[model samples]
Every structure is written in structure tokens, then in C-alpha cells.
Target: MISFKKQLLLSMIYTFILVLLFQSTALSCTTLIVTPGATIDGSMLVAHSDDNHLIDQRIIYVPAMDHQEGELRPVYCSAAAIDEFPQYASFFYPRINATDRGPGYNTPGFPQSIPLGYIPQVAHTYAYFDGSYGIMNENQLMFGECTDGAKVQLDPKPEKLIFYSSELSRVALERCKTAREAVELMGKLIDEYGYYGTGETLPVADPKEAWVMEMAPSPDETGGLWVAKKVPDGEIFVAANQFRIREIDPDDPDILFSSNLFEIAEKHGWWKAADGHLDWLKTVSLGEYNHPYYSLRRVWRLFSMVAPSREFSPWVEDGFTRDYPFSIQPDQKLSVRDVMMLMRDHYEGTEFDLTKGIAAGPFGNPSRCYGPNDGQGDVGNPNRELLGAWERPISVFYCGYSTICQGKADLPDPIGGILWVGLDKPSETLFIPFFAGVQSLPLSFSQVDTAQFSRDSAWWAFNFVSNWANLNYKAMRADIALMQDKYELKMLELLPVVQKTALEIYQSNPDLAREYLTNYSTQNAEFLVKEWWNFADQLIVRYDDGMFSEPKKMAQQVGYPQEWLDLTDWSQGPITYKKRN
Candidate 1:
């Protein structure tokens, strides 16, 4: 028999534990969802920035698998996955085998026998494609996710068997074919196995359709509750580490969700029938409103860029009542170039522009260095003082990897999907296209360790060049941009030719088509890396110590902005008439 005091003490301890768990697993990421009609080429586009606090940003490729009926599969989690399940160590190795060889069947085994351990296995698995740290199975079913914290109690408690978000994504990518299928598959999995990580918003897209699904674990700790809304054909939607889905329409064929989404919310007292339709964002959100300066500002910035006519204030004080629609009709149809440029936006020409102030330093660099608790503190807590911190822009410098994924319905799946990946900040790195059907990834794109600087790694190569340009950003950015535009334009121009050739070959021999694409992807990636290395050398020589080094050209001197000079309280007066005594 337990005493009343003992019971009370245990309850308090459990509450404290939940609080700690929620704080540790908080994450920030950005995603952009565009429907077919919003795009110039009638291709659905989904862009994601996997931003974290200094995690390795290597591109992981999981080859399609064909597994036997009874074979067991191992599930591993990312380093951040440990926060939600502290009992489990971070699985450092690749979750799926890079090669096709399974465990027991190596070298034509003497007898097919199961290993002496209990391992979980799915009933069956399918072939799929993955790129830019996200999954896009061979079916051209692509998926990307952003993390947004939910109610603290909804977080997975300690020592529970659950699936991390990344693991769930990998499984769905491997198993499902379309956006709707992936959403339903993930929902089913979460219901049975339970979701273990922080809240997440996944933008799942196929060649013909796109859906943004917001998910968070239920407060009952049984499983996750989710709601997915389809992006209308002619609309565009963006999410920046925040829930964007508003009302629910269960009867709508476009909107698919967990069966118990509203039931669980009502059970937790987060929803009411009188609220009319179940509001996923309002019901599941961690309840930080009135802090537009936090995550909401990024949403505002994106809306302002795409639909300037539809006014959205970054300074909105109300939290749940934000008038920003779930999706908006863009001012004009967008191209791949327009979407890529949007990924590189930093609120230029707006009041929240990170580049115009003294924080940008003398070179007009929009990048700002973030410390622990710098921008995230005010997200779910509006009372926290901002202290005039620089706005969190889309093209941040510390992103591990960013991708612009395109799914086109007009062409064959192999020839349609393209993953335009940038190694670092989109503004600094070139988006080299990797076709979906490529048989092999470029060596330069694989096995990157961000901690060590290696010339062979594409990520390091671009980072080296971008870091050098940052030194004399104001002076050197124009040259870099020129090179960027030239190379990217060349790739774009060559795409049609490559696609036509590949399509003709695919009609004859799909294998031959894949081989052609593999060679093309590898060649372009290797060439881009080689060119970036040369560009880095040129930048060093041209902007050496802030002076031009061309033999025939005079050195170009640059000065601080007059506003900056005035703010420093320094004099621009001529040298004193009399020498200082």
C-alpha cells in the first residue's frame, strides 16, 4: 500500500520527467510544398532544409530492397532520436544495407537458417529511391519532414517501444508508392507501434498530388494522432518548423488522417465539438501564440515572397487566430528556378531582412551565427524577451543539406522526378540535379563527415568555397553569383536533351536508360565540385586580403555603409591640421 505523500511525490517526478523530455527533443526545420498548378511545368515540388545543431549533413542513399517473407529488418534512429528514447543509443551506421546482400544468404549459404535472436521484420518490402537525406522510392513517391514541438505531455515517455520520425519516414518510403499511400501507411504504423520523437510536419508528394501531414503523439501515450491535408492543385503551401494545417474534413477524399485523430484530441480535452471542424494546429500545438517573431515570421516571410498581394504580417500578435491560409494561389506560376531562388530567400526588400542591419557585418552577409537557445526560445513561449535578435531567415548558413524535390506527372517516373540538392546554404551552394533513376550516386556525394574537411567530399568543397567568399562577401558575392547562374543555367539547358535521350533509351531498354542517367548525374556532380574548387582558388586570388590581384586592374577599395559608420560614432573628418603633440 502506498501512502498519499508517496503517490504525490511520484506524480510530481513524472511531470518533471515529461518536461525534460520535451525540451531535449525540440527541433527546427523548414519545408515548402507546391502543387502542380502553382508550378510552370505542372510538377509538384517539395523543398526541405534539414537544419539542426551541427549534425553531419551527409546524403544517405538506401538502395531498393527485395526481402523474403520471413526475413527480419533492423530499425535504427538518428543522433537526435536518442532524445526521445534515451535508453537506446544512436545508431551510427547506415540503417539499411547499402548493398543487396542480406545477412544469412551471403556466398550461397550451406543452409538457410535464422540467426539466434529475435529481430522484427515487416511482412514484405519494396524497391524505392532516396536522395538528399529524404526518401523517394523508385515509384517517384517523395517525402520530406520538418519538426515542430507539440504539447509536452504528448511527447514519448522514457523506455517505450516506438518509431522515431526518421525511421518511420524510411519505412514509408520503402513500402508506399504515392503521397496518400505513404500517409496511410505511416498513420497505420504509428497507431500500431507508436511514435517516439517530437512533433513533425511531413510534406509528402507524388507526381500528381501533394499532401502536408502534421503528426504528434497522443497524450495517452498509446500512439500518435495526425491530420493530413492535400495541397490543392493550384495552390502553394510552406511550413517552417510550425504546424500549418488548420481545419479537418474527414469526408474529403483529398484529406486523409488517423482514425482516432479527433477522438484522442477530445479525450485529452484539446478539442471541442463546438469548435466546428477539428483544428489540427490549434488542438495539437504546444500553445505558444502571440510570438510572431519566432517560427511564425518564417511562415510570413515565405507567404510574402510567393503571394505579395495577399498581405501577411510577420508582426501578428495573435497565435492561433493567424489569418494566413493553409494554401494560397501564388502571384504567378513558379518555375524550378523560382522555387530554388525562394529557397535562398532571406527576406530581402522586407523589414525583417537580415542583410540590411549591422548584424550582417560590413559585407552584407545575411547569414547569422546561432548559439544554443538563440532563436528557438521564443517559439512556444511568447513571454521570453527577444533582445533584438536577428530574424531567422530561410537561407541559413548552418543547414546540413537542403533539397528541392520535383515530381512530374507528364513523363515516366524514371524520367520525371529530380532531386536538386545543395550541400550547404542554398545561397552559397549550387543545386546539382540527380535524376531519380540513377543507378549509382557520385562518390563525391557519399560518405561525408562534416567535422573533417575533405577535398573529395562535395559538401566540404562547396563549404570551402562559400566560407572563402564570406570573408569579402560584399565584394566577392557578385563573382560567385555569376558562376552559380552560369553553371546552373547550363544544367537546366542540358536537362531537356538529357531527358529526351533517356526517354528514347528507356523505351528500348530501361536498364540502358538508368545507366545513361547514372553517368550524367555523376558527371555533372563531379564537374560541379571541380568547378567550385577552381572558383574557390579564383576568389582567394581576386579578393586576397580585400584587394583585387589582377595584374592589369587597380585594387578596388570597399568601405562600410555610411549608416554603419554614423552608428559607430566615428569621425570622417580630415586629418588634424596640426600634428598631434
Candidate 2:
């Protein structure tokens, strides 16, 4: 039997250990949205380093329309379309849409065909050109997550192939003089040959601004294939796993984009003749069953936060299902900040949030689930819990056009129009501008793999800082915020200085530029390590129950909430330094 004081200490230790264990077991990745718009040229390409260390990059793209029969090729395309095509597209284009085997068939039988020697397979792959990888092009702009309406297939054409590269629109724009001609040509190509990825709805700043097209594969198609619609001007759209461009307005060139919506529907007799506003997309394709529940919640969350006037709550379910306004015209033009926030949003302050109180609220912690409190839960149906770690990673990868422009040949160097792909984990990753014009990177950035705990890599720095903060969320969140503020300011201060110095070196000596960027990377890594250590030290010293006694201050350091203040008694039981045997 333990003494009363010892028992109290043991209880506190046990609770702390349990919570810490929960935290360790609960962590998972978050979703992020990349918004790099399309470019006519294939110069700038950027993607998040999937390895998390930012060493190995993930390149994604839509295969060229004409090259469907050739060897396997990859291209960057839209986000929502990709999700829809693989995870949800099949739900729409069922073979039952055709003759004989109709709706009652249960499973939609779609066909798969590949031209040339290219055998189709699905699983994420690196988007690349020639051989080398890492953002080496200036024209590679990848914008994703254009929330559109639902898609369905009244008549399934399993043999029809599709393209998914976002650049198809831009390619059309470059070939055509006006937007109308561009849309027409794009439609023709898509109608003749299907696409394989999400179409990019490009709005570029240039001699020609075009909207790229994209589409999803029919249920019958092999592993991976997507199609895109011919983009029309003056008719803006939104997308979130649902098809956006539905009907083909052949006469109204200003209000359509697709290979041939009317032609295809007519050929298959999928569209209704009598209609006030015929949603051909719904007629030919499929709409989200739980539009509000699964699809629009993301958009509603964004619009609610950025443009309150257009706000729609996920919890506010009404009688009318599809009656809610579908498309929203932003009161203001989209900006980088808007894109960034959308990518980082976690349904905070909403009903859908998976992390509010461990039950099924929306705080959506990426690491752990709420039910059972224990780490392990049902494996097959992880979604039963409030927060599903495996289900949703915290930050989704973001690929968007930066205001900067650079040429392709110069991308091998980080300074040249190098791609700006990055992990969208807020306060954890920095979007350091890599210009096509710059010559090199700081040493701190490149030389990081060697660092250990004492020696910190940029990857390790963020992991340590974020994990340390999570140790006592009630206390450490503030410290984490404080750390972010200081770190960002420091980065802002250092980047320009580093940029200017590196530019000067590049002009004087190009070789020096490479060395400079590499060094800068290292220096940036070092700065992060130094700051993180200080923050971690504060956590260790303050929470150790030796140098400090005030549980409130400890809470402050770890970022605990006010409600947890009562829990302070747990920390005050007694400081035990005994190591677990």
C-alpha cells in the first residue's frame, strides 16, 4: 500500500502518462488545399515533399490528351476532381445507365481501355518532366479544390477516356486567340479523347487568360482516368467533389465549358427537353447525396469565415436538401491568404469538427480520436469516433501560383523559378519565396539531414516544437503561438536579407548562388532549432514541478484552456522524479 501523499503523486503521474500516451497515439495528418493556378508553359512545378523532411517531392499531373496511348505520363490537375474520380466518381457513371442492365444492376459496370503501351494504375506518383525532380520549372502552376456541383452518368461510356491535367485550358488558351475559341477547341479535344485528371480552371495574368478543363473517369474505365469540361468565360464556378460544368450552351459561348455536354447528352438521350433551368450535369452525371453533410461543409466553412455574408453552417440542416444556394460569387477576388486559410481549416467552431469534446465535435485533432479514450479503436470503421487520425491528415498539400515568374531552365537551382510547393501545416512550415531569378539557397536550408536531436533538422525542429506544445495543450498553445509569431518575424527579417545577398552573389558568381541558398536553408534550420530548444526548455523547467510551483503559469506555458484550471490539483500532488522501471 502506498502512503497518502505517494498515492496522490502516483495518481497524478498515472493521469499525466495516460494523457500523454493518448496524445502520442492520437496524432495524425491534416488536410491542405494547394491553389497554384495553371500556366500556359510547363516551367514552374511545385508540390509538398511527401517525405515530410521536404527532401523527396510529390509531383502530380494529368496525362496529355493526345498521349493517352503512349507510355505512362503524369501531370498536375485539380484537387476536388481527383477526389471525386477515384473515391466517388464511380457512384455516378454506372453501366446501368445504358440499355439492358439498367438501374437495378446494383454495381455500375464501367469499362477500362488504354492506348499505346501505357498500362494504367492508381496510387500517388511524383509529377516530373525529363528525369530530375524538385520544383525545377517556372510554368508549373497547380491549383486545386475548385468546389463544383454533383456529377452523374445517365448513359455510361466505359470506353471513353478522359484527361485530368489542369493545363488543358491554358493549352487551349495559348492555341486560341480569344476565350471563346479556346473553350471551343478544348471541348472538341475532350469530346474526341477523354481526360485523366481534374481540369484546371485557370485565371492567369497574361496576354490570354483561360480556364482549363478536367473530368473524372466512367466507372468502367481502368484504375485512373479523368475528363475536363471546356471552360466558358463570365460564368465562374465552384467545386468540392461535385461536377460543376453541366450543360453545353453552344450559342451562349460566354456561359459554357466542356467537350460537348449537349451533344453527349443528346447522343445518350440523358437530358430533359422541358426545363426552366436544366441541370444537365445532374441529369448526365450525379450530385452529392449528402451535399451539405459531406460536400458543401468545406465551402460553407470557408465562406463563413472569409466572407461572413455567404456563411453557411454545417450543423444547420434544413428541410430542403438541394435547394440551398449552390454557387457563390466571392464579394472580393480570391487572394493567397484566403487560399491558405481554406487549406488549413479544421472545422473549428462547427458541428462537423471531430475534436470538440472527444465525442463527435469538430475540433478535429489529427492525431487521436475521441471515443473510448484509449488509443486503439475499431480498425475498419475508424470514422465512428469524433476525430479519425487515419481518416483525415491535418494539413492537405497546397500547389498554387505565386506572384513570382521564372523560366524553366533555371529551376534546378532553388533561386531560379523553383516551385513553391510546401506542406500547409500552419506555424510549422514556412513558404519561403523561391524565385526563378534568384541564384542560390542559404546553407541552412539544404544541409539538414545530418542533424540529430541535439543537432536539429528543419523537419525535426517543427516536429519537436509541435509535439512539445501538445504535451500540455492547455498550457503550451500560447507558447506555441508566441513561438510562431517570433519565428515568422525572424524569417521575414532574414529572407529578404538572404535574398539580396544571394542575388548579388549570383550576379558576381552563379556557383556562389547555389552555395548561398544551401547555406540559407541551413541557417533557417539552425534558427528554428535554437528557438524551439528555448521553448522546450521552458516546458521542461516549468512543468518539472521543481523550479516552478504555480500550475496556472505551467498551464500558460503549455497553452491549456481556462476550464482546465480545476485540473491544476493534478499537477500539484507532488513532483516525482522516479524513472519507470
Candidate 3:
């Protein structure tokens, strides 16, 4: 028979496990938007950080294709899709190897081809020159997404149709040439087949314009309800796991949405004609507005960074009163580097800075290894009860990958678009430029093994350096940032020359231009990987343990911060040892 004490302990353990399971379902991602006029180089920019803990992400290159008439394209669901929509038995089929099948339907890591549905194929699919989590086609069109879950009753109904946000983004990239066209196509597809993902925000951009669209599953489980708002030139927008759109102007040309957007809400009793005007966010949001810490804090952090002069408080008793605009015009034009820096924000110098307190450890690292208390609560000790709150900074260490895509109208499509990509934590990794005309991806950028270390893999290399720096961040970050600046600045400096040369080659032969751009991208990636390895070796030797090793001199001790020392109880700490004679 078990003791009473054992029974109590078992009960507590079971409760913690339940809490962890609940928190794991929360979606986390951030997307930043910039209009062409808001950027210094006249490029529309949209950046995203895929902060999901599962990190097997790698760069994928999908070449353009031309199909004959009477051809049909099969749609397959990924492991993520299956996990997200378990009710759809089709997505849960046995995994198949891409090696066993032919081309045109497979994606890297998503080898399992469980045919979910089929869509009509276009006559000609543009080249997948540059791409990220979503898609970017040869015409300088790109899409980025952030999950903003809707009300519980609005969970996807798999029986109607099956196109998740990712698949929709993919199809749009293949079929559409402009931002408006993509938006129209997406609306048509979602309306006809239905949308099957959680609430999502997609920023679709071309060389000339960009639009922010928010879509949610229909309450009646029939289809999707959505609204797309165009970001005017010289303005910026951002979304971080929460709906940002407030009201809609149905007749406005800049606003595009489903015909049943308001009808569905009214039919389901989610809204009423007596409510005056339809507010999409108020009606469709998952009701997370009352919880500031989970989502609103991120929105506040982003707004504060882009427009510091504006008074935005991270903490407020009620979020409804906080009238933060959907988009804002910056005081000055932003640069590509500025967007990259914004992706690396950690709420520094703000009241919510995670690195400033005792929770940051003695080394002052801004990052936390995992979610609060591993999503568990303590019942045995009241003092140990899980707070379950951590600052959701843009540049967290566990991010799978992050991307900044630039679409410039002034240049040719091949020379205009640039996808700046980084693996792991954005703060620790360098953003390498991948032009839209590049033909092939480097081997280092295509590594798939996330479970084990590989010296040849770029993701592993950056993770290695980042993990080490987290050990003594305050002391070692200077060295890491110095190297980061060196590589990033050099890449920025070479951009103009690269574009000019590619244009010159394109004037005579376009194929030659593609080859040159591809070679330049591959070579630059290889060089960056080699440099990171060298820097890793130097870091290992320079900061081993708690000492700083000099090249030709004795090592120096690096101690903890004075504030950390002061917080410790050290009344009997000074232990004196007798020196040996």
C-alpha cells in the first residue's frame, strides 16, 4: 500500500502535467510590415520569426514549372497540418518518402505525401527563386504569416474543405503575380473550398504594394471569414499572435474581404445589425484581449520600438481602451538594417526588459531556455507556483528560423527582391541575402537534421555559438555582436555592386544573369558558414569557463554582476585558505 505522502505527490505531478499540456497548444509567431515609401531603398519589407520550438527548418528551393493542359495538382498535408487538424483522417495517413515518388509535389522535410485534396494547375508556374516559411515567387511577390487563433467554437471543420494557411500561401505564390492578385485568389479559394487553419494573419507583398489579411474559421463550420486591409505607402504594420484589425469599411477599395464575412457572423449570432458597424477583431477574435501578458505585450513592445514618441503602455487593466492604431507612419524612413534590428528586439530599456532582473541569471542573458516553468504549476510549495509568464520578445533563442523579404519596384524582378534569412535566434545569427534570381541553394543552408549536431549545417553552427554565449552573456555578447556587425555590414555594402552586375548581365542574357546571381548567393553562404566556424573556435578558446583567455597573456577572471552579488546572502562567504609555504 502506498503512503499518504506518496499519494499527495502523485496528485501534484498529475496536475503539473495537465497544465503543461494546456500551454503547449498556444501558437507563437511575429510578423512585421513596412510599405515601400516607409523604407529608405523604396522596398516593401515584411519580416517573420517562426518561434515554434521544433527546429528542423532549412531553406528550400522550388524551381519554376510549365505544365500541359488537362493536368491536375495534388495537395498534401504536412505533419504540422495533421497535428493541427486531427479530425481530418486524410492527413493522418502513413508517411511516404519523396525518393519513392516523382517531382512537382514534394517539399523538403515534408516527404510524406498524404493526398488531402487537389487543385487545378496553372499553365505556367513562376520560378521559386527566393522563398521562406511562406513563399516568394520569381515576380518579387512574397507572403508571411502569424497565427492568431479565433473563438473556440470557430475551430476548423475538416469535412467542408482543406486548405491551411501555409498551403494557401504556397498556391498563391505559384499562381499569382501581384499582391492584389494574390489577395483576390486567396479570398476566392477560401470562399470556394474553405479555410482549415487556426486564425491567421498573412502579409502579402509585391514590388509595389502590400496588404494585411486576417482570416478565421467560420463559426457555422462551413467556410472562412476574412478581411484584407492594404497598408498605404509610408506606413508600417505588425502582428504578433493577435488580431490587429478593428473595424472594416466594406465599400473601401483598400479593404477587400469575403462576401459572407458579415453574414456568417450575423447568422451565427456572433454579431447583429443593431451593433451599428461591423468590427472584425471584436467579433471574431478568440477573446484574448483581456489577457494582456499573453499577446498584447508583444504588440505594445513593437509599437514602442517603431514610434517611441507615442505613449504606449505594456500593462493596462483593460485592453479595449488601448486605441493603438492598426498602422503608423514612422518619423523617418527605415532601412533594411533597421528592420533586421527590430526583429532582434528584447524590450531593452523598457519596464518589461526580461534581462534586467534576477530571473536573467548572474550573466544577464535576455533569453529564457523554455516557456515559464515548462508550462507547469507547483502545488507542494506555494512559493514555487508557476507564474506562467515570460516576456515574448521578437528574438527568442528557440526560433526555428526568421526571414526579412524586400520587394523593390525600381529594379527588375530578379534584381529587386531579396530574402534575408537567418537560422535559430535572430539576435545571434547573421542575415544572409538570397536574391530572387538564385538558381540553387547551398548545401549548408539545406541541412535537415535538428536532433543532432552537424558541423556542415548552418543552423547547427549558429545554435552552437548562441548556446555558448548564453552561458556568460554580459561578458561574451560583445564578441558575438562585433562579428555579427562585420558580416552584416559587408553584405549590405556588396548589395549595390551585386545588383548592378546582375542587371548588366541581364541586358545581354537573362540565363547568364540567373547563373551569376545563383553563384554569388551560394558562394557568399559558404563563406559565411566558414567564418562562423572560425568564430566559434575563437570563442571556445577566448571564453572558457569563467575566465577570459588572452592570445599571449594570462587569463582574466570574469565575475557576476554587482547587483547579482548584492542579492546573494554572503555574510559567511569570505573563506580564507592558508597559502602553502
Candidate 4:
């Protein structure tokens, strides 16, 4: 066995190598959970921003299957690494194969996804909608994932452990029907087998409840350590690539954890239970990555927005500040639209508004994707190693895609759950509802090759619009919102009528109900993707050369905003031709 010193040294060496090859998995991802009672319709919601580097943006469908008693479920390395290793995966994914690569490898890519281990298979596995992570199963079990960096960064080696958060969530979705079942199952698996990859927070939700489960790699041979706390039915929970579960209390029914959780931490000197109950974040985590406020600022913003009466301050002493509560009751009950608004934010009205700064450019586009390493290092800052960091907003320009798992308790699983998928940056996307009943998605949704641009992929259409909007964001934003409202509001009204029809069909035959629901979902996606492509073309003509034009009029040259013009560095010489020539 390696000594403790050797483990720490090996982890650091592995981490340094990862940053040089693959960008840090700690980049950015915001995930949240809204409990049933906190939502206006009394439905649980789990939302995630798949904000990683070069991710496979396609959404794949996996149908339920029966298994033999003696069958063992094969587990591979992380599926999250699909962002880079396309060869390790088939674009035609999860459905066709049993041992398809798990997005579980959140560390560096394996040369090939050879299985780390296997577990006993259940008699029946439910169908699920999967992106990089398993979204929702036929039972309405859902997951929202965020990768958080920890002090112990174990390399996902062959013999030690294999499952990353994506794979763990996928397995949970296939096997469990409720949030409690998932948390318990995941904890049991981690105890018996092992977990690999970086620190991860998964908001697992079902029609009845939602829970925040946080996991980190164990430094010893035990595999992994995990802790989960159920968000109260009357409150909401948010995690932005950091552990939110605190105070390991075994007696608390709301909290669930592994037996060796504290023992592992104590052995590593991360925490000592003798002092008090273990503080999970302070003990097990590296706090935040990239910058100090990188995680907290987003977390604070969500709390402030949901319950403005609390007036949560944007400022905190550091990332570990106790200023923000783990969960909170909102000022008003939220709807699915309200939750989407939470996901699509750039801190617009607040002091930290990304669109208001000089860096936002002349058009007020809030995309600040450039990293500290992009330019010369920030020589002035004390933490010279970091160089600098950007304020990561909820809706980021680099986001591959996002999902809101909307789960309703009043209806059956098929009708109760909708995996609302947005292809690009949340700010630039129109969320399309894909019901749990769908056995297949529109083929266009699964046909993305990020290495090359293609008209065949639905993701590219939104990608095109998002990238193009930067040219004249101010003019184009309003134009985009018009369409957003047109479809979204219409869909909002259309959903109830469709639900009524599906329910009527369900009474006679479940198969027919699924068929009807599937047609409505796939057809809407097909129509929306085509319309969005047309919108992108219209945006090209309307905003060409920084001019604004519509169907009946000639192009109008709308100059830069006065605020932008004033902020511009004319000192570099917007030189007068009379003087210079």
C-alpha cells in the first residue's frame, strides 16, 4: 500500500498532467434542485448546465430492458470525457449496447473505455433520456450533475475505481424509482465497490422529492466517500461545482452517508470528528476552482433572486463563508419557467452583471469565456499561480447544453416528467420539452459532430444563433426574445391541452398514450430545429455589418451604445485623419 504522503504526491502529479492535456474539469457547471412543495405546481425540478470543454452535445435515448439473473452490469470509465475522445464512444450511443462507455470518466480520457469493474444486474432496467448524464428514467428519477474539484484528485486507474458522477447517476436512474432510493443505492455501491474521478454534486430528484448528494474520491483503497442531505420539501437547494452538504450527522434522517466517510477524512487529516461533527466542505473539498468567488457568486445570485426579501449580499469573505445557507425557502413558489429563468442568467441587474462591463464589448454580449491563461498572467495579484479568474454567470457562452428535469407528482411517470433540453448557451436557447415516455428523440438531436459544422444537427442551429448574436447582441437579443416568447408561451398553453388528450388516451391503452406523446414531442423538436435554423439565417441578414433590417425595410446602421462608446479606449488612437495624415 502507498503511504499517505505518496497518495498526496501522486494526486498532485496526476492533476498537473490533466491541466496540461485536458482543461480542468473544474471549469464551470451550475446545478440546482427545487423540492415539490417549493414549486408552484408542486413538482420537483433538477436543473444542470453541461458547461464543459468539447462535450458531445447530442441527446440519446435508452429504452428499458429485462436482464438474466446471473448477469453482471459492466462499468467503464467516465462518459464526461466524451468532450474529447469521440473514438472511445459511438455517436449512436447508450441504447444499442450494454457496456457503452460511461461518461463516468471525469478525469483524463482513457485510451479506450475498458471496464474498471462490474456489478450484479437487476431483473429489469427502466428507459432513460441521456445527454452526457442520464437525465430522467421511466419512473421520473432524475439527476443534475456538477463536477467539483477536491484536494484528493485520484487518477481514474484500472484497478482502483471506475464510476464517475455521470455513470453513477446513469446507474441510479436505471435502477431506482425515487431520490431516496438513488441516494441509498449510490451510497451502498460506493461502500461495496468504489468511486473514481473528481468531486461531484448530483441533485437527484423524482416526482416526490429531491436530494443533494456529494461525492469525492477516497485517498485510500476504499474507492470513494459520499454524503447526501435531503432538501426540505419547502425549500430549494443549489450547488455550483462545490459540495453543499455540511455537518455529517448520522442520526439525522435527512442526511445519508457512507460508514467510513469520517474515518477516511480523519485518516487524511481533512477533519477530526473529535473536534465536532465533520464539516464536509471544509474538510473534504478544495473550496472553489479558477477563482475565489467562482462558485459562491453564482450560488449567492440564485438565493437572492429566488427570495429577494432575504437580500442576500453578493459579497462573502471567501468561498467557504457561512453567509449563505445550504437551503432556503423562496419568497414565492416557483414555476418551471421561473426555474429556467434561474438557469438563464448573466447577473443582469446586479452589480456583478456580466453584460454591463467594459469587457462585454460594444454590443453588451455577456459571454466572458476567455480564461486567465489566455493573456499574459495577472502580475499584480498575490495568487500569481492562478493569474486571474472570470466571474462565471449561470448562463455561460461556452455551455454545451443544459437540462431541467421537471417532475410532477400528480400524474404517472410518463406524463409526469419532461426533460426540457436546451442545445446551446441557456441565454441563447429555447428549451424544448422531451417527455419521459419518448422511446426515441428526433434523429437530428443525436447527430452532432462538434469537430465540424453541420446543418444536419439541431445543436448547430442554436450554436449558430448564439455565436452570431455576439456581432450585435443588443439588437439581436430583443429579436431572439420575441421568438422565445412566441414558442415558449404557446407551448405553455399547448401543454395542458396535450396532457388532457394523453390522459384520455392513457385510460384505454398505455401503449397508445406513449405513442401519442412521443409523436407530439418528436414532431415539435423537428419543427423547432428547422425554424431555429431559419431564424439564424434571418439574423445574418438583419444584423449584417452591424446594421438592423427586417422584412420590409432597408438595413439601418445602428451605432454602438453611448455607454460602450464612452468606455472604449480612444486613448489608443481613434486617431483623427487630419492630424495623423
Best by TM-score: 4
Count backbone clashes in candidate 1.
4
Model 1: pairs clashing at backbone N, Cα or C within 3 Å: 128-137, 128-138, 129-137, 129-138
lDDT of 2 at 262: 43
Q: Using Cα atoms with residue i matched to residue i, what is each candidate's TM-score against the true structure?
A: 0.86, 0.51, 0.88, 0.90
Candidate ranking (lDDT, best to worst): 4, 3, 1, 2
lDDT of 4 by residue, 209-252 (tens): 88889988888955688999988888999888778887888799
**lDDT by candidate, in order shown:** 0.70, 0.36, 0.72, 0.78
Q: Report each candidate's C-alpha RMSD, comma-separated, in the order given.
A: 7.9, 14.2, 6.7, 6.6
- Evaluated against the true structure, the overall lDDT of model 2 is 0.36
Candidate 3 off by > 4 Å: 1-26, 78-111, 129-132, 153-159, 289-291, 371-386, 574-581
lDDT of 2 by residue, 1-581 (tens): 77755753564465345434432222111112212222223232222222122111112211212322333432222221222122222211120112211122222223221221212322322221110012222233322223222232212223344333333443432233333454455455454555543222232211123233334433333322123343222112334333444444456544554434444545456564564344544543444322223334544555465446655555544312342343344455443333433444456555545444543212123343323443332121223443323223223222111112222333333343333323224434434444433233333333223113423334344455555544444345455556655655666466557666777787878767756765565455455556665666666766553233355554333344444444456455546876534
Name the regions of candidate 1 deviating beyond 4 angstroms: 1-26, 81-87, 91-133, 153-160, 287-291, 372-375, 378-386, 554-556, 572-574, 577-581
- Cα lDDT of model 4 overall? 0.78
Candidate 2 deviant stretches above 4 angstroms:
1-137, 140-142, 145-193, 196-214, 219-239, 244-248, 252-256, 266-270, 275-285, 289-292, 311-342, 349-355, 358-424, 436-469, 489-581
Weakest ten-residue segment in model 1 by summed lDDT: 109-118
Model 4 residue 17 lDDT score: 59
- Alpha-carbon shift of residue 547 in model 4 (angstroms): 1.4
By TM-score, rank the candidates, best first: 4, 3, 1, 2
